[model samples]
Target chain A: MKIFIDPPNSLILFDLVERFGHEPLSVMATIQERVDNLEIDMPPMNVTLTDVKNGLKYAGIEVPSGIRGRLAVWGPLIDQAEAAIIMEDAPYSFGCVGCHRTNLLVDFLVRKRKLPTIEIDYPRTEEDARNMVIRVKEFLEGLK
Target chain B: MVRETRLVVISPLSEITPDQITRKVHSLGYEVTVKETCYGAVLEGPPETVSKVMQELRALDPLGIYSKIRGFPLGDPKRCRAQHGSRPGFSQLQTEWQSLSLVEKGLECALRGDKAEDIDIPERIPVKDLQRFCEEVE
Candidate 1:
């Protein structure tokens, strides 16, 4: 099952691959990137991506219809997502925890739109982040 | 004295984990304060709770605390209204306007037989303009 993992700090990603026994495919920059590359990997394998606005600025990358701006501004984008792992903060430049404005959108998508969602807590330290990755991997393994 | 138990949970108000704030407070043996405002409350609790709360607060990095301050001043039972000559305190104005907007939207939805969810209320409303509007309506 493909999962949209929000951007965790770089250290967290390291632990996810090293300790969790999961292959880190690619760090997601934009929603369109995921959509374009979805076919490359078949279903049943998880593909994780961070919510970066980089792809949306490419020369020919057409803005996904009905979505634009910061993820908070693009509430429609998450409507079709199967499941999501929302991290607390990958970039402190934005709000520390997941964006509050977008949270209501996540809630709408989860409760009203019926998307499965798991809100990840912000890691207090590098070690804690690593543990989170381990825990998340263990939880996902249980599902399989 | 009416002891107002407040839980001023100051996370980034984003994707906070369950009990993360409470755990930190409890680690220092302080009960959680329950209020959302950051600077608007004067806390009221047992001396231990108050002391530990301050100590825990001092331990937190000022920049990273993302604190929500919520508490009431423990004192005599008296309504602390602003002086007659002072500037008007529109403490509840925001909620009032929000309620009014929701009502207007509801009425519109009822008349048109549309679902309330379909209507989008602008999250950022101009409070000064709203206060004026409220006065005009009244």
Candidate 2:
């Protein structure tokens, strides 16, 4: 399953999902792939307003001003996801995702896409950790 | 006074193991449990001690260590915010934090000064303009 992990930058979740044999899809890796293949040597970006507008639609972010910028980067991430794992209260995100607006949209998108999702919190204790792993494992296994 | 606690991750490029990390962390003398997670160990402990340990670990391997702050402020009751009977809480301050965790990756691609080419910006939002906007966020 191509599980779309929001915050897709999480090292732990990325590893765990892959270790279990499911492909982990993240916005970072997707964006990196796009940037790496930019048309040989034109400027960094040579896109138009319509292209960005479409990206916003794909990414599910709706704002009057800055949505275009965010959509440009995250649009493809939404395109490639099959399932989702939304980890709440992830320990030490280090400012990777700060906009609550985007957060809500991600939630909205998961619902809109009707993707199978498992919403969880970063564990605070050994028991919590154990249960979290079990829940995640069960969710992944169910995918098969 | 509120004490600080955190969940720290020590990622060693290809040079170390969780056991080695546990040993190194143990030598520091703070009481923490170093759990063996996928990329490395996730150690939980007081903030100051965790910071010192993280610094030492980084010195051992400059670009490999990573640490993360967990839920509430270490020991601050105000973070509780329920006011006992007044407020209904965000229900819990840390409950939905992970949802707000992805913009940094976007910032990285968009704010790349010269070598930036990740997405299709809608003209008005140039990379330089986005970089400036990112700088002002915090």
Candidate 3:
């Protein structure tokens, strides 16, 4: 299964996904592809020049392009996923997910995609650690 | 150059005190806001300096430190405001902490490797040779 891990830059999760025999979708890998392949010339799909000029004026009807620009990058990854492992409150990892605005947008995107998802909080204790591994292993095994 | 604001989490798996860890990292020369939550202190600061402080803190409890870089620089007008900005409000800090606590624990489980007794395991994880890593940094 293609496992989309949140805080997409987490090498730990990236390694873990690979260790479990699944492909991990991470921002680090995505950015590297863009940089390596020279895909930087295109415009972001979620935002347009009109949206930028309008800003947040329409409230519920529209959003700031900053959020959209990010959504454009991560949204496709979520769509390609068969299952997802999302970590909340990871405002410390090296990904766009750490930013509050992007975090919320990603969460909404995950929900909308409706893939088989397992959400976990970042762990702090041995017991929490044990549960985390158990849950992750279970989620991965479930994919089989 | 715009300063990058980083949110760093410290959580010692063993019995080490998080507050003491906070005090030790605070003494380092970076201007940061240290908030101690359930998972650990979330230090917001510039990226380069924060990297320096993290080296020191990681030596104290290597597996404990986990950081996520933020999009907005520290004290950006868009990020600071709740009234106009889409960023999360201060009330959400606790919520974010609680949520990331899971990420912290999950990180330990994933990164800790199967053999805690093997020193090489520590090396493989971020800590790299626990005692030696600390000594070199010190």
- Candidate number achieving the greatest lDDT relative to the actual structure: 3
- lDDT for each residue of candidate 1 in A23-135, tens digit (9 for 90 to 100): 32212223224323535442111122322243243212364312223342233335334455565543342211234544444445445544455555544443433444444
Model 3 scores a C-alpha lDDT of 0.57
lDDT of 2 at B36: 58
State which candidate has the highest TM-score.
2
- lDDT ranking, best first: 3, 2, 1
lDDT, candidate 1, residue A110?
47
CAPRI band of model 1? incorrect
Please state the error at residue A138 of candidate 1 in Å: 1.7
* lDDT (CA) per prediction: 0.36, 0.52, 0.57
Candidate 2: segments with Cα more than 4 A from true spot = A40-51, A58-65, A92-96, B1-138
DockQ for candidate 1, C-alpha atoms: 0.01
Model 3 docking category: incorrect
Per-residue accuracy of model 1 over B1-138 as CA lDDT, tens digit each:
223332232223223332444555556654535222332223346545654574455245322222111221322122133423211112322222223222223323333443222223369778998999999999
Per-residue alpha-carbon lDDT of candidate 3 for residues B48-104, written as tens digits (9 for 90 to 100): 766577567767755455544443444445345554544442333444444444545
Better of 1 and 2 by TM-score: 2
Predicted complexes: DockQ each: 0.01, 0.02, 0.07
Clashes in each model (backbone N, CA, C under 3 Å)?
10, 9, 17
List TM-score per model, in order.
0.28, 0.47, 0.46
Model 2 docking category: incorrect
Chain B TM-score of every predicted model: 0.30, 0.44, 0.47
